[model samples]
Target: MKNVKLISLALSMLICFVVSAQERTITGTISDKSGQALPGVNVQIQKTKKSATTDFDGKYNIQAQKGDVILITFIGYQNQTKTIGDENIINVVLQEDNQSLQEVVVTTAMASKKRKATKSSTQMVQGKVAGVAISSGYVQYAPSQSIVVRDVVSLSPKNEPLYILDGVPVKSDQFAKINPNDIQDVKVLKDKDATSTYGSKASNGVVVIDTKNGIYKNLTEKELDAKLNIVHPAPTPNQEDYDAFVENAFESPKTAPLSTFSIDVDNASYTNIRRFINNGQAVPKDAVRVEEMVNFFKYNYPQPKDQHPFSINTELSDSPWNTKNQILRIGLQGKNIATENLPASNMVFLIDVSGSMEDDNKLPLLIQSMKILVNELRAKDNVAIVVYAGAAGLVLPPTSGDEKETINDALESLQAGGSTAGGAGIELAYKIAAENFIKDGNNRVILATDGDFNVGSSSNSDMEKLIEQKRKTGVFLTCLGYGMGNYKDSKMETLADKGNGNYAYIDNIQEANRFLGKEFKGSMFAIAKDVKIQIEFNPKQVQAYRLIGYENRKLRPEDFKNDAIDAGELGSNHTVTALYEIIPAGVESDYLNQQPDALKYTKVQETANNYNDELATIKFRYKKPDGDKSIEMVNVIPNKTVALNKASDDFKFSTAVAWFGLKLRDSKLISNKSTTDILKLAKQGLSRDSEGYKAEFIRLVESAKNVL
Candidate 1:
């Protein structure tokens, strides 16, 4: 009887063990906000303590009896407990928890608040942001100064920013064509940290433009919906050219022989004259430095009536990096079209000739560029030149717009030198402009340089304060960038934003024509200000995601209000684009697995409608610069990720370009990147290429590959 009982008990024990061994298995991954793996977390069965610690992947395995509780714990994190119900597998992510009293970093315009720091270095800090390259082709127009934020089309090999200009997703680069005089300011965001809100495309960067409007009169629907046409006259003879022609025409051969500055001729009172402008001295009564006067004067053109085409007219000269012995000329149908003999116009040609401006594409391009504007001068405009080297100095004085010879001599006389004293140069330029304050005419300083204000007065706050002070004088600023290496793009954009001006990057002649000639008001005249863009993602319509660019342009949840925060402007035909990469739910792969410990800690909640596939909705708020009211524009983008093969040429090209930038910066996020990919994308996207944009992309790709 005892033997029989033992046999039955052993059989019973074996049956129970067999039942316990039939448990189910589940799998997944664990990560932090930046997608890095989490490790060493504790994952366990809640009531029974039957548990497992997360392996290197924060993954775990456990056996629960029917219904069981699972609890997870980690340092500096809240403990999470979950019940194992009908679900076979569970995944999680533990969120960081910080007390309200804990010290943190808060970014303010003026200063940085660091609660803990061993030491600090003298690094330059500013509020300007960076842009993700859209395409090697558009790179020809990369850092395009016009910072309008609207382009919804996928990246083409030649597409610019994808901000919706006016209404559609036009290339925000259109803003680059407007005259700075028409704009009130511009702001840019360049890093993922600042622009994540706009998603993948913004991952490249984001630009905000501020335009100027008239008094508070609200327009009708027709007025609001009216198509805007931004047209600027050709860069014929602006004030600079006018002065040169005038000086040349009025040789005064009969007068006493003039003193040449450095000719085996003379270096006479030029330095003294330089010192005078530095000291804010009035123009000497008998001294005629035509270039100075042309740059320092202002012109008030009759605003075109609403019925006529809104036109823009201005000239910007991009000079050679080294001004010694260089000759380049651009001519057109006429000179500054001044009906009343070239009115007493005030002009500021803000030149950015920094060390970064050393390349042929930069300083050299600038020198040649200035010739275009010099060709478009009228006798009435007055000009001045304030240059920043290691420090600021007056390269030229306020001379008559009619003194063409004098102006040309002054322009041809400059040479590349030490560090960029952009800040000092700006300070002097504004002072000169303010001192010669024009009542109602146009007073603008046109800055030409690669956007790098590194050495002195390089703080964001300092620049902001200085610009505000200058703007109070009702004087405007415009930025013209030259070169590629070490381009301080974010910096140039920020100054333009604060100075109520426009920003542009000139890579070649066509760009100059498009900007200095084609779109003046959109670039210079501000039609709006404090433009705000908000993208709301419907959680029900999307899954896991990331914003690719515009890292630095991210706004705090609260910045959309209070009326004090600044934004970007819009130019006619401007297109801005924002792209997002989505990770679809239920599409499980190795990339989706999380460790058991992390899963226990993370309590992810997904609603039933999470597969809407709609990426995000865009909302825009803007105020007419000179007015008191606000306006808006909005759009929606569905969440769709096509095979890389089917993507738009613009999209593919942009992706390739972004890959190149990542390679340049050695970023780990982008992988398997090469010139081959760029070439491939360009080949795939080159449909109906315009102005050789697609061809250029191919050329650049070949060049990069060849050099490699």
Candidate 2:
């Protein structure tokens, strides 16, 4: 009996220990009171560091003990803590913080809880918030200087916080369209706990704006309208121009066997398109460069292994738009080199300080961005500052990278005035760079401008000719475009294209960090130049093919072998993706209208039956930065195809982006694809998204659905 009792007691103790240590998975959705799901909300196990963020669908699953407390937190909302119970699923509705049952109030330590409506909402609470900074002035064609909370998140000219009006997140630029008097109160979420739930898009923080209508019953509609100046919405801003290029059409292997083009790594079009969508404006068709859009995102292609500076990857899959067609994806991954391994660089800051750049987002943002770049410079690197307004002048001359203070001071001392003599500025910048040129290293001129070239040599053709001539000097160029309203995108693009450099539109500091900091090696160091691609399709296996995007990159067939012809440059760790839509043999489509009649002069040889196993052969040619001759690489694509769902995440995600671009452009070429479809594919392909860019893309697509 004693032994039995002892055994029973021991078993009971072991059971209790097991129960206490057991963990259960808790699944839940975090949403606002209106039932809209919130992405990026933090769900944590109280007293423990374990946490998870709600996905794009506002759903999250976290493990916790049965009795442990679950803490749910999001910016702009009250914190909620609940004890885990028998329920396996817990759904939460977060209440807005500082909001009364009837009135909206921004919480602060002061006794004054009510806010008076004014002409500018930022002005009303400018000094009231501790960390919020506001710069306001009377300027024609420009609104009050933007309100920055805590630190500036974006170096882009419009470094404004993401605005939420009445529980709906709106673009920062759209705030001006909302009457300031209609605003009830504005709450700023600056800390990580508050902004993390919004993910990368909210890295700049968020502003929860409560509007006035229906909040107060005492105010009459007529009085409210008069007070708010709610006469009409603000007019849309004008967009810059782009040279229209037709998409590549199907070519017969019997006649035109070679599809040749220069490699393009510029990603300006994608972000520029994002700017249009976020601002609630229609995307310009010309701004939708499919190749640029696709190349913006990084892929999981393998790095170089041999003597080549890049590795070629190919994938053949069923077309997402049409099952009758197959899509071929070709990717080139540049070798990844550590920043420390990069060659010394000689950089010149060619800044446009014309009167147009006086706007907060122009020269000011440029200065901030340049400072970030300066911070990344090493002892071996050298920098010079050159400015152009009425005339071009060198402010700082070949300062060592170690002397950061000197370079920073020079950048800060620049003031905006005079007309933009862009041509002269380029000449001076190149001259400075050449003077301190780092042979066998990176010698480049960084140009920051609104692209408003109003002075001498302002014409696009003249500027292009000058940049083309300067390229022979071995000084590469990089164009950083800023601001809107009179932005010369066309002129800037022309210069970058002709100058053997890359172009980027820096709208915020996040972009500056992405280009100048995170991607420092790829942005500054050129691994290969004159990179070109030519593909030969097997006439037997494929009936027709259309090169998706790369409209501006198409080169004459003979240009592939001619070393004199200039092509795009590939930087360290850069990836370029191109897609081709193909119609399989025996498939009938109207797109193949250009099929040629039998040749009357010469007999055409039929492809061998064994050729059915091969789809196409991809050939690449590139030159070392200093090499005089081009080296070639070849990749043969198999005829095997995989189901769309079975394709790699890289393939799916790129397709999603391409489809989104199509919808944004309202392209007639788009089949039955929808934004919802794109979102679904993107979610499935959101693998290895360490930077949260793919997740942000999902959110962007969701927002686009509502706005479009």
Candidate 3:
């Protein structure tokens, strides 16, 4: 009986040991093959209810017993097992599954010579693979729809499918340069199972093309011959160019009593400058057009209430930079017509498909931008496409806007190659516009480019003359500048100015939506043409003054009366703002030139007793869309002074923008002001910012503070 009790006690101890071991805790970390943490991995103890999921850091703890089987599994990777031993901590490294890999589609064996029969390598991809989609058009990136494999997983602007040629990865454009005849086989890999091996870049999809000769081996005679006879043209590089405009200096109001300039509604400078600042580059001095920056954001100016297409508003306040000087704000608010009420549009998309436009920002962005504009077209609207690259050609004839798919298909058919022939492209675009002319309607040519014109009639003078002549056809122009590096702001401004059009720079899709989708009517239709502003400052109240910006837009005092002379065009609901820095008659300083030595040659007219009470007389002249004659309006502003803090939000916001421009140019005229000050002023003016553009401007100011 004693021996039986001892054996029973020993068995009880063994049972206790097993029970204790079964309830122990196991802890470890989980990661992928690259040693990166893998969150959400399942860590379970087999045959038990105890399991834990990896935290964000890939660390996990689970209840397990010694010798218990533990399972760790994650999507896109192979399941792993571990038998818990004496060790309390057991790390795991999961391997991706090979057999269950993302299903890759490959073309059933076709003879290389058979593939060679196609005009382009992209053609070889069509109808061969089950899941792969191949489209053809003059698209921004691919000549087709980026060779998508099923649905793409990228949220980037450049979601180009990756190509691996004969064990070497190549750019899509480079693949286009390779001879189609030299390719032996093609395979497309989709999803993470097949693309994980390529890391993050293969998320969009992958195309593996086996060439006749691998990089490891010398080309066979057949392959060499095929390459030498290939018809693919090599991509050429582009050079950058921009026009230089000297900054306007402060003018002596006593000698030059009048400031005359065409009112500019273009906002290209603001967006382009934003691009430069976001890229951590110093803004080019010439790129800082203050007028464009000021006009980029809309103000609270009242809409026109009478026969005039727009209303004129003026404000005077102490300058933010130099408290001693005063600022005069001139604003023009154009009439806002509902989209349904706007005239029918006749649009010709003058697109540049030159090799220089191969960059994602240049051609691909252009395609997406145009797509937005295309979606906004009405059923009666007409659309045409003219592309220039080496030479100009009509890709799509005039088509009804109601046929959106057909227009989109034509847009997708575009491809970038060869040299830029912008001039010939413009001529062709103008011809097509004239062929489909719509009288008393919105007849306009929307030219989109990086402004790299190389072939015939490429000079600014030539382009100006060509567009100037084309402007007589009653077909207005809208210059949409795209890309960077080689952007020709001067040329685009010149074209828009000479062609009676507006200019806008599109940096990304958000901007594209802003210009083409949200503000479609205003961007495409014009309310007034040949819009000019002439302000005659009274020497009695003002000693000296300078027109901010408009250096390239200045007109002779006599040009304002010449209806034949061309000026800027005002679009529907467009707002133009001009700021002037003036020195009061009593405020003495070095900038005044001492009243120009009392005007030795001519006798000065005696001022009327009430002239000092009138600060300035503002005159505006513009022609109706169909009228050749001009109508004039005049307004007299009394001498007024207001504190910077008491000025209207419109005045304050414009002052902030002007101050930011002066800071960017490092101007010696305006006193030094910090970006923080500008941000503060901008925030106060952020009322009624429903579109969020003003909010975006605030962010830009913050970004500029970091870089500047």
Candidate 4:
């Protein structure tokens, strides 16, 4: 009886241990009482270091055992604690804490001795705060200065923090003009503290100042507005332009058996569209290039084993948006040649230093991007710098890549000014590239610009003609677009398309790293040139088909065989993906509403006896980087189709991207699928996302749903 009691007590102790150690995921959304999603809210499991921050969508997840308490805190909101219960999800709404917000403990304590020694208020706070940033628009003593506390919350048009003197709101200029001797105490209110007190005007935070003899007066909104002469600036007009092209339409395979187009490796559209979504602006319909967006991501495919430089992959699956129709994905994986195996390179940095490039995102970003590429170069590689403003000039002569200091010095010395002579810059850059060209090596000109050309052959047609002429010299072009508000995307696209080059938009430093650092070899080294894809669908298998995206890259059926015809280049380690929406034979789709009437004189015929299982035959033509002639390879896609759930991650991800592009374009062909569906499909293919790009894409979709 004692042995039995001992065994039963041990078993009970083990059960208790398991229950205490078990943990489950707790997910919730953090928002304010106004239903506005509050991002960056800190949530912590009580008495534990485990914590999570709300994402841009105001959602967070943490692991905790049942009965554990979670503490939630945001700067301007009241702190709340919730005990984890049987429910897996616990959402908490925080209320405004006006009382606690009224007193803000100074983030940086200023010593009285230092304050006395300082000449101005700016100096008093310059180095005191850990997070505050101070900058002078003019001279050091100039009244045009700006002070920021923590992150900017989009208050004024210039994103400046609100300045409150005594009880009256003042501008930064007024704050700067105040005498340091008259100031008594200064407090910085940030995050929710400022937002809740001053409302939207203090969204960027507030800098409250108390003067020796200043009076505090309660003024009405109208009185405050009149005192500040607050004229809300009109929205700046967007001067950006994109190449307009109609989305590809469905065609009957009986009438048009072959679909041909040039392969595009450029990812400019995806990044440009991302910029729009991030800025909470509607993406322009013309800016949505489905193929570019789909091809931006790399897919897992076997490398070529033969003499060819790329491998072909094909998959047929049920359409995600439409049930009756099917989708065909064609992927090409460019052989990844190691950096050591790459040929020597002769590169020219063609930069536009035009007055329009004065923005921080323009000329400055271009120089930083070039520096990244320079760091990757070997001793065998050489680069020359060419700048164009009023006229083109050689800022740096051809220097070996090993001379990093010299190259960076020249890049740093560049300043933006004068009119844009883009055509002349291109001419000079190509000349330099051709002169320093290495035999059987990578010869290219990297053009960094906002694509705004106002002087000397500035028209798009003129630029196209010039680029076409330069392409004959065996030099490639890589266009890197920068800046906004006057970005000429059409001009950049024209130059890239005609100059035998790829295009990318460098919106931020991270993008520079992505294009120039992580993707150095793929963006700079071309393995094959004039790469084209032509598809011949079996009429018996496919009734109507439409090539998604590539509306501007379509080629004539005869062009596929013509060696003289120019096409896109395949860079080393680059992957290109294309999608074709197909209406199988006997299956109907609304996309075929405008199908042409059957021919009366000629009858459509199909000989499927031998190739009954074949859905289509894909033909790829590409030329060796230095070779004149083209080599062709063919692959046959089987008629077999997999369910959407069973498709490869590459197919599902690419399809989700294409579908999102269609939705952005408001294409009538696709069903009215919401962004939620896109998000779900994208998450299904999140495998092998080591770079976290797929996860970022999911967040982008979430953001788009709210804005779109």
Pairs of residues at least 3 apart in sequence or in different chains that clash in candidate 4? 76-192, 76-193
Off by over 4 Å in 4: 1-232, 594-601, 605-610
TM-score winner: 4
For the record, the alpha-carbon RMSD of candidate 4 to the native fold, in angstroms, is: 12.6
- Residue by residue across 1-708, what tens digits does model 4's lDDT show? 999999999999999889867888898888988797776688999888677667555777788998899999975468999998899888889985444221223432122222322235445455554334334311122234356555523333345566776656765655655555555555766666765455444555677766555533344444545554555568789999998888888888788889999999999999999989887888989988998889888899889898889998889999988878999999888999999999999999999998998666787678778878998999999999999999999999999999998998788677778999988998899989988888899999999999999999999999999999999999999999998789999999898888889999998766786789779989999999999999999888898899999998999999999999999999999999999999999885667766667788777664548477999999999999888899999998999999999999888998999999999999988875778889889999888864456887898899898667
Q: Which portions of model 2 miss their true places by more than 4 Å? A: 1-227, 230-239, 607-610
Against the reference, the lDDT scores of all candidates come to 0.46, 0.77, 0.78, 0.82
* Stretches > 4 Å off in candidate 3: 1-239
Could you give candidate 1's per-residue lDDT for residues 485-547 as a string of tens digits? 355545665576676665666655444544554334344434445555555555443333333
Candidate 2 on 1-708: residue-level lDDT in tens? Answer: 999999999999999889766878888888988898877688889888677667656777788878889889885679999899888799999987655333223342223254433336445555544334333311111344555544523323334455666656554444455554555555565545333444233434566666655242223444444544557477566756677766566666667788899888888887777777666666777778888888888999998899999999988887777668888899999999888999999999999988889765687678878877888899999999899999999898898999998998788677777888888888889888888887899999999998889888888899988988999988888889888777878888888888888988887656675787667778889999989999999878888787888887888899989998888999999999999888888898766776667878866666446677899888999999877799988888888888898999999999888778767666666575677778888888889865456776787788776567
Query: TM-score of every model?
Result: 0.43, 0.72, 0.70, 0.73
All candidates: CA RMSD (Å)? 35.7, 11.2, 18.8, 12.6
Q: Which regions of candidate 1 are displaced past 4 Å?
A: 1-346, 352-365, 374-384, 389-409, 416-421, 432-443, 450-461, 468-476, 482-526, 589-614, 625-630, 638-649, 663-667, 671-674, 706-708
How would the candidate models be sorted by lDDT, starting from the highest?
Answer: 4, 3, 2, 1
